[model samples]
Target: MSAIAIDQPTYEVGARKWLITITVITCAIMELIDTSIVNVATRQIAGNLGATVEETAWVITAYAISNIIIIPLTGFLGDIFGRKNYFTASVLLFTIASFMCGFSGSIWMLIAWRFVQGIGGGALLATAQTVLVETFPPDELNKANGIFGAGIVMGPTLGPVLGGYLTDNYSWHWIFYVNIPIGIAAAILSWKYIKGTKTEMKGKIDYWGILALVVGIGSLQMVLEEGERKDWFSSLFIVIFSILAIGGICLFILRELKAKNPVVDLRVLRFRNVAVGSALRFAFGLSIYCSIFLYPVFVQGFLGWNATRTGLLILPSAFLTGMLMGVNGALIKKGISPKALLIFGFAMVIAYEYITYMLATPAAGEWDFFWPQLVRGLGFGFIFVPAASLTLAGLKGKDIGQASGLSNMLQLLGGSVGLALINTYVARRIVAHRVDLMGNLSIYNPESNERLQMLTTQLIEQGNSSQQAQQMAMSIMERSLSTQSSIIAYGEGFMMIGVICAVILPLVFMARIKKGEALDVGSAH
Candidate 1:
């Protein structure tokens, strides 16, 4: 491999480049924020659209499937058309779709619009990263990444909080409508400021590779999104789609390996650092996405916190993560090794998880969760920027786009799978915990008798007759048992994630990056 000279671009600090950076970063953050913003508002959306909870979830599922399908193709599209043109087009598409989403008359219409929005939104993420990297000189790349990293981590962190607030204070439709002004601003800035690298290419479009990618990623995302709801393979839809996903992905790999101008250049994986970084990215995505998904459910479902309160509780963590990313980026520029930062990051995340696991309870307050989540925010900032920088360290020019697409794809896939796994685990664990708790409630147990008698007496005082009071007391007891079981299940789930992060730590040593080699660090945006 020939070494490309790292030419520094001349620009005054906080000038045109910075404006472009902010614009592109806004686009990226808008895309990511949409990915999870609907999560907290799903129930509201379902009711408003006259749909079932399971059906309205397609608002999220459709977007995710579309996102995974489009991400790998983004780099190729950016190259074929100028990045600026493609990005402007995407922002326009996203903005129009957002308006449509807010105006939808039915759940299916909303889902369709969301899928369209995802295609547009997916481009913003990869394109933003490439644009940010190209805008900055090599020396300032870390700082640029810090800015991008803030968006990447904070978007997901703030999604629930933002969605909850919007849904509770205004209406669910506003969650989609809110993107309009931001998208329009980003579109204007992109047209005025963002520029594409000149690429001279002569090749046919990879139609076959595109087909395979859509099939593979679309089917995979469907399985991940609907698995828990459909009871996995018990449904014919799940079984058929699972087979299609596996088959399509296999063919995609083979087709990309042979294609002259593949949608996703599979050859980039030959670089050891890129390969390892991709793996770690998958794990990181799994950990981060699953934690965010689980936290909202635990707080709202088990703890009975209002959406606004839950959202407010999570806001500080996002701010802390942004601050930490800036600090970590500076530390990297000052000669701290990525590997060292990664180890510390993993340890801190594990500590955060352990704290959550130990302290989570049915009656726990928001204050009980604040500090541990803040620690998690810090750990996430440390991990994401360094990992991203290390992953593409040796690549050049177009290879950067390819690696960025591939890395982002893995993260998306990992998040989908991780959320599915956690959802399934939570369901099973709740049942198992319930059974165990029930088994301990023997008539001879003095504490059990005392609790039953107390509950019965309370029911009698509330105007129930003796037999009715006994039945009501039993119902309350069962509800209490289920509630406690859910708390334990959630705690165990967090602990399992912590263990998973700890186990992956050993792979850091095997990364084939030399200390002095210039790493290709791109913004997570």
Candidate 2:
């Protein structure tokens, strides 16, 4: 609403410009890695802390809720505190939280520290993008986005891998401990290299809007993350949160629309390009995290792969994504429309999902997944930069920060919703498939009788008596049936995501950027 600044920090050029890029990108990766890295270590944490796996889950749920709450507020916070100061403070907060998490003696203590860590991590991600936008000259915007995109994709991809290795060799504490050095380095670099200039934002702090956001987004995230695990609407906990989510969101939107200085500028969405780009981002997040979430479950749960082995299968694809980041950037610089690239990405991702769907069986080996994952890598390489760049393409100056924060928030929410839906869908499908499979086991079914007889004979050969052999054979058949049911359900889930990708593909055309124009231009004008 007004320009009021206490200090004006100069922007960097030359080697320092690139150094700042590295600093913020590293911070982004560290934040994202913390997002999923804890997933692999939950079991270990449960055992060590003497808690149930379900209870230990709060370690993750708390972090996610915190992330959702803080992300949309980053732009406002950066404006108020000064970007570099806020960023360095965030890094320090995250680093301190990590130290507390590592030394946590109780499960609740760890969860609390993880929540604190999430506050810091969420700020890191949103602010990192804004920082990159400010650091690069308008002409080289794609290059900045490309580097940031690689880190965005790389962080989640690397999380499970690094988590698996650390948990396997050292301990779960090391996962948190690992962040200590990285966070410290990032804080130092950000303070030293990033500009401290404040945005031209001056207004009454929208405390009411902030409270509404916490209630709304926080409740929504809780429902999404915990819904499936708690049986969705069937649980009273979910029903209460669902009501709170809807009411709080409605109230927040009303307040922000009326407030002279809203914490999140909803009006940014009126820019058609930003609006369309945000929608595209939502769909992109749904597809990306869904595929990532489902694959490991399929491999490790059904295909008999261990955590480390499952993570290793994704390594080659991650490497390919990193390389393609530069290629995609070059193409964008060569006057390519991100819409075209997004369409290509959607096609490749659809292919990857369908291929993976077909391969979801008991007999699928690592080699069977290799090519399909590479296809997924290509999809990410094409999508991340374009989706991100296009989302904020129509905004300028301070609006970039606001739009970037909101876009990132939507991306995260999409992933949360996708995970919840797939989990619920897969669970229900498994039950249905199991029931259908069970019907084929009637005494009157000749094939079933023959198979049972053969299994009985094999058990007898293994030295069991007649009755014992028969019982063992039946148990074996039941286990086999359950496994087959799960495989079918997971396969259907994969198909579901592929179909979603196809459905959202046409929306790319809705983006309205002019050909060959600089990305930072406020086309909304």
Candidate 3:
């Protein structure tokens, strides 16, 4: 037997085992939902709080920053406080913060509460994965991972749908308020059913490691979230954060490696599977989040779709992913290689991105995206199941928690970096495309003169004077030019995701699962 199976606590069985699964998965989904739910309601939130939209963005930014900073430390926290107790406390914290957030009287007040909520929410993710891993037997681990994958896939998809519904029908506050009952139930169930463990402290706490973690990861997340808005390195704010991110991260690595009691065990990456799997997860996160960010903007901003409708466009794919999670789990149980599954998944993702790139015209409708979205769903289903199972496959007792934390942290960071890069790239492309279009729109160009004349004649025919017609024609031309530039830029952005996925696909070869590794089936199916 592997050291993990030998040293780990007894796996939960019977009804209690199932109960624990439900509890942890529920908590995880609740946390994931909060991450994206507020996005759809941001406009209403800004209006109600009397804050500018830019200022209201801080509400999301604060949550993300705290969330990333705390994610990597969850394993340590779970170890120090015991998983069950830490998880229960986190649930309570998240619940209470959600309540406070709903009742906040001002924008900054809401932002503060959201950050606290994120601290609580961050624990729910990595720790919940560990809880589920420990809850199931070795032979069923793949099943456990698949079940969790479904929740992970569905959570972000459901966020905007639920947010749009609650915000449109009621108010923005209800988005936060909605978490109250769910959090309460998750907390109660977790405390009741989840197993607990306690370990004696071996040495002084690594206070320096903790500080480095906060400074490094916090500054890095801040840079990702705010860099594009601040115009990247050109802004003093981004530059300062950039320097701190590098310095703090370097210090963090050195401290963790040499500390007697490290805040995060960086030594786990020495395992090949953990190292390669974490890198692949980073790419996976980048592709998924960038696609999510891009498609909505394209449809809503350029194609004039409503938030609810755009969200619905993503729903069918989410459903498909939920179903495929089970099938992928079964495949893994049958001795299918996780690396192969990962490669196939990325292939599907690349194909989806290519399809979307071709379909990104201004005239695209809901029906036009059906196949590509389904492909994306297939890709996610393949990726998420194997990712968790493969990354921590051979890890020993405490190492499982440490590796899980590291892997999840990298995944989130990947999404952050991808979004920042995509935002900058698309913006630059738009400006360049617009300049090119403007150059061809000169009065000396025959096509430009002919088009302007046609537009002016149409306005004149509609009873406008020649002067008014000419002015309106110019305005229409400028608007069209801008729209065209945006369309071309966004199309290229979709292709960019495919290119990135293609680059990442080859990394799967480096992640080799042993011929007959033993793992328990998870409750995902």
State TM-scores per candidate.
0.95, 0.97, 0.96
Candidate 3, position 417, lDDT: 89
In lDDT terms, how accurate is model 2? 0.86
Would you list the C-alpha lDDT of every candidate in the order shown?
0.84, 0.86, 0.86
The sequence of per-residue lDDT tens digits that candidate 1 reaches over residues 229-348 is: 999999999999999999999999999998777778889899887887788788789888888888888898888887677767777877787888778878878888888888888888
What lDDT tens digits, residue by residue, belong to model 3 across residues 71-131? 9888777767777899999999999999999999999999999999999999998788888
The TM-score between candidate 3 and the true structure equals: 0.96
Query: lDDT of candidate 3 vs native?
Result: 0.86
Off by over 4 Å in 2: 1-11, 199-201, 521-525
Over 316-365, each residue of candidate 2 has an lDDT whose tens digit, in order, gives 89888888888887898898888999899889999998998889889889
Q: How would the candidate models be sorted by lDDT, starting from the highest? A: 2, 3, 1
- Candidate 1 segments whose C-alpha is farther than 4 A from its true place: 1-14, 519-525
